[model samples]
Target: MQNQAEIQKLLVLCGTHSQTAFEQLYQQASPKLYGTAMRLLQNGELADEALQEAFVHIWHKASEYDPEKGSAFAWMATIVRYRALDIIRREKSQQNRSEAMANEQLALQQGEDFFIHELHVDEDQHLQLLQECLKALDSQQRKSVLLSYYYGYSHSEMVTRLKRPLGTIKSWIRRGMESVRECMQR
Candidate 1:
């Protein structure tokens, strides 16, 4: 932790776009800010992301810091906390979407004949079309999409369960969905 005066001085220098001052400020404040993020997120990766995003904000908005209003550390910590909160809200939104998808899947499963009849499509033909579209995907993409939509697994959960990186899992799901959509349209 840095003394308030030193932090204030560093922030002032950062406002002038001094990289050295920004680096020093990051070194001084990151641990505490990261701790604040971790406390809010309870996930190391999310905390790291929040810390990085907060630092970027600090760098850009350093000129706005006002000693009369509050301490420099408090301002930075607030930024980190807000970023973590954003991540939490995004995760909750995704969970809600997953739940909705799961409910739709359940409805389809339970009312398959009625659903197909309502659509004026033969049940076997509709199922075969979907199966064929699924089979068109690469195995990894297929698995990722199925886990996400059918099992209501979050992207983070898929990363853990699939033993793949987050970006890769997201890409697989996205590409898989696009391919499925194109195939269904055909």
Candidate 2:
């Protein structure tokens, strides 16, 4: 009945490449993940495609997960989110580059509002609690998570932002998640 139980059920299906379980997980999780991708990409068709790819990746990657690493939902959510970001970067890199010269003002405004207002942050109180919890992380950990979650960057993008090695960014993200998990437990 727990989330982990549901995830374990899905992972079994995934490991064995079960069609029915794949449909079940897609039915269950893809709507929210697709909506997340749509909001980030602002392109429904692309979001739909990305959602499918993300689910496929999820199926492939599910066995690598452990409940002890994080909640099934959070781990799966990370997979969906990063997959969408990857698609956007790959397909729209040129568009993004031109925004600087083409619609700088509009892009700037929308980009600012996108992170601050469009991301559907939980609430002031919840964010305050999260921020307080995030204080446990050192600066790099905080930056990596924020860049990835708020800005929708992939792990490689995070490395570019931090000017650090990929392994370092990976370590920061994992350690930061662990720190936040511990903080929330208290």
Candidate 3:
């Protein structure tokens, strides 16, 4: 767990919509939350979904954080855990659906190979746009985004490999994603 005082500060900043503070909070807290989700759900895919949903909730509800209730990390962890549990429950209720059925549905979504093979020109345009957007990001943001999304490194892994503070890595990825979205919209 991170220092309570520091977590509190970040929470305060998050309430004010400070992206840097939110990034720092995520870096400081996400591993524990992810671990909690994994433990509860026991599936990497479900854990990822829970963590993503928890973060969206956190971003929207940062202002509701109350130190009087518990440490900031604990509060965040609770959210992730609950989200994981909910997903587990939902999955359990849908257990009658076979894995083969799920796979078939997924395959159906990808059944159209036109985009993959026939639309070479459109694919080229998208690839060019992506490259241009990536180029617009700062070096740290670019590297963080690429290493995480392209190479499948977790933020914790990136912290170790990049040898930078977790908060900075989180900030880089967050800002990098925003830049990519904005650029793509253009």
Candidate 4:
């Protein structure tokens, strides 16, 4: 790893769009940042992604770095840490949703009929209503929502599976949900 002064100087040059300085900065600092990501994410693929994203952020926001606050390495590491944390949070939420779906399926198989008893609605009817609401969505919206909520796919996964941009995937899911909510409310 480069010394703090050298890293700081490289960061300043990167802010000026100096490609050589950026390359040097990346080569010098990426190992430590990758290690930081690996420690936080505990998965090689996720750590790689976090490191890549952190570098992208650092490249764009290099000028925003303030030497008065901390060392350049610390600022870069903070970006990686936050990215890894986001991935962790997203994975946990997906796992929770998957577990809930599994529990609901298990209850149904056991003839518990919790929805009928608790919500005072026939389970079949509830499911049918939801299906109809989902069908009312545009094809892309429906697909996006199903991939995200039913299959518990992260946005990044959806982007890869559906071949859509991240913002587009998010928009489709959001609008799809809003439409479903309106339909259900009626």
Expressed as tens digits, the lDDT of each residue in 1-186 for candidate 1 is 869899999998999999999999999989888999999999999999999999999899999998899988889889999999999998897677677656646655775533344456675775667767876799899878878876578788788777999999999999999999999888
The TM-score leader among the candidates is 4
The deviation in Å at residue 88 for candidate 1 is: 0.7
lDDT of 3 by residue, 11-128 (tens): 8789899999999988988888899999888899999999999999999999999988888888888889889989987776445333433453364368632222333565587766
Residue 140, model 3, lDDT: 81
- Please give, for residues 50-106, the per-residue lDDT of candidate 2 as tens digits: 888878788787667776777766777787789788987787764553443244336
Query: Candidate 2, 72: how far from true, in Å?
Result: 1.7
Residue range with the least summed lDDT across 10 consecutive positions in model 1: 111-120
Models sorted by TM-score, best on top: 4, 1, 3, 2
Best by lDDT: 4
lDDT of 4 at 94: 69
lDDT of each: 0.85, 0.71, 0.80, 0.86
TM-score of each: 0.62, 0.46, 0.51, 0.66
Which residue pairs show collisions in model 2? none
